[model samples]
Structure formats: C-alpha cells, structure tokens
Target: METFDETDRRILSVLQREADIALEELGARVGLSRNACWRRVRALETRGVITGRVALLDPAKLGFGLMVFIQVHAARHDAEWLEKFGRAVREMPEILGVYRMTGDLDYLIRARVADVADYDKLYQRLIRKVELNDVSASFVMEELKDALALPL
Candidate 1:
C-alpha cells in the first residue's frame, strides 16, 4: 500500500467531491501552484490513485426500477463452466455487478430491471446459459443508503 501525504489526501478529497473543479482553484485550495498541482495529479494517476472519472446515473430514471440480488450455484466446479458463466455475465447489461463469493453461493449477482417480468426473463436467460444446480434471488424493498464514496 502507498502512503499518502496530507496534500495528496486533500487533493483526493477535493477531487472526489468536485471532479470538475478548475485546476487553478484546486491548486489554490491545496496551497500549491497550478503546475505543482498538475504534476501531483499526474503522479497520482500514474500510480493508479485515480482510476477513471464517470457520471453516475439513476437506475429508476433509466427504466430499471427493480433491484435484485441473485445467488448462483453451479452444478459442477470446472474451469470451462466458470469461464462460460463469467462471459455470459459480462454480456448482460442488467447485471450491474458479479462476484465470486466465498460462502455457500458460488456467484453473487446484482441486477436491475423494469419489473418482475423483466427479472423472470433475465433469470430464464441466465439459467439457459449456465448450468446451475440452484439459484436464489432477493428483491430489494428499499435502499436506505447507497454511496460510492470511500472513506479516506
């Protein structure tokens, strides 16, 4: 792990809150010249501190109002089967995230869809594509808190 200095932490905090802040303003806030600030930002990027910036979208507004978590258990553990399942998951737009878990479930998938019918279609498609011994799903009733910001 890389140790971050006060300036780096300040830069990261400011950037996380306001990514569109002007370089001059960011430098002023961080007590550095524009050139120095730019260099630090560049170094941070080179070191993989800043991965990539993206616009977070609203799922409900995009017609995906239902959020569901699906637990998948494969019929058998094999390299080929796991590869195929992973590929299928990558091609699925509704699948927001897929993880290889360490519990009873082999894979945990987060999906968003329009309705129950949409979920049914997605479930059928997934089952048809992968050889699953068991599949269980849980629909999210309410999202109390969902934030991407990591505590630094």
Candidate 2:
C-alpha cells in the first residue's frame, strides 16, 4: 500500500464518515482546490484505498435479527477441501464474513439469521457442505459497537 500524506489522510477521514459528500465540499473541508482534491480521490481509488462506496443497512430491518459468530475447524489443510469450503462460504447468503485465523480455529465466520432455529438450519447446511471437524457458535446478545471505518 502507498503511504498517504497529511492531505490524503484528511480526505480519507472525511470520506470515511460520509462517502456521499460532494467533491466541492470535500475539497473545501481539506483546504484543497476542486481539481487537486479530485486527483487525490481518484488516486485513492486507483490504489485501492477507497475500494467502493456502499450503503450501510440495518440487519434487523433486513430480516436478519440474530447475529452469530462461528469458529470452524477443518479436518485438515487440503487444497481441494479449502477451495470447496471457500466456495460454499461465498455462496451462502447468511454468511456475511469469513476469516482464516492463526489461533485454535481454522476459520471464523460472522453470520446473521432470523433466530436460533434459523441458525440451527444454517449450521446443518454449512456442516453438510464443508468437511469441518469441529464447529463452535456464539450468539451476540448485545452489540456495543460495530464500525466499518478505519482510524485514519
């Protein structure tokens, strides 16, 4: 990744809060001319710092009331099995995120479902699709904080 200058950092900080902010407004806030600010923003996007803008949604309103984290342990590290597991995870709508870990678990998954029963059904389907040796799930009772913005 390319190192960001002070101006670039300022631009990123403001953009993280509100990606829809107008280019003129962003330039004004960062004390840059419209053209300079536009170039900086374009560079950020080109360098993959700004991946893409998106609308943050309410999970509950979207019919995903239950948030659960699952730790999955695969039987072994086989290329074919890993590929299949990755593909299954990508295809599962309920699985919002997946991370390969360095701890006791092979993979950590974040998923949202309707309820406990819904989670149970998802669990069954997930295990059947992947050759997981062990699986542990924990339901989130209260979400204290969830922020996607990086501290720039």
By TM-score, the best candidate is 2
| lDDT tens digits by residue: candidate 1, 39-149 | 999999999999977777899999999999999888889999989998889989999999989988888999999999999999999888888899999999999988777
The count of residue-pair clashes in candidate 1 stands at: 0
Question: Which residue pairs collide in model 1, if any?
Answer: none
RMSD of candidate 2 to true structure, Å: 1.1
Please write out the lDDT profile of model 2 over residues 1-152, one tens digit for every residue: 67889999999999998999999999999999999999999999998989999888899998998999999999879899999999999989999999999988889999999999999999999888888899999999999999988988
Question: What would the TM-score be for candidate 2 when compared with the true structure?
Answer: 0.95
The local distance difference test score of model 2 is 0.94
Q: What TM-score do all the candidates reach, one by one? A: 0.91, 0.95
Model 2 Cα shift for residue 20 (angstroms): 0.7
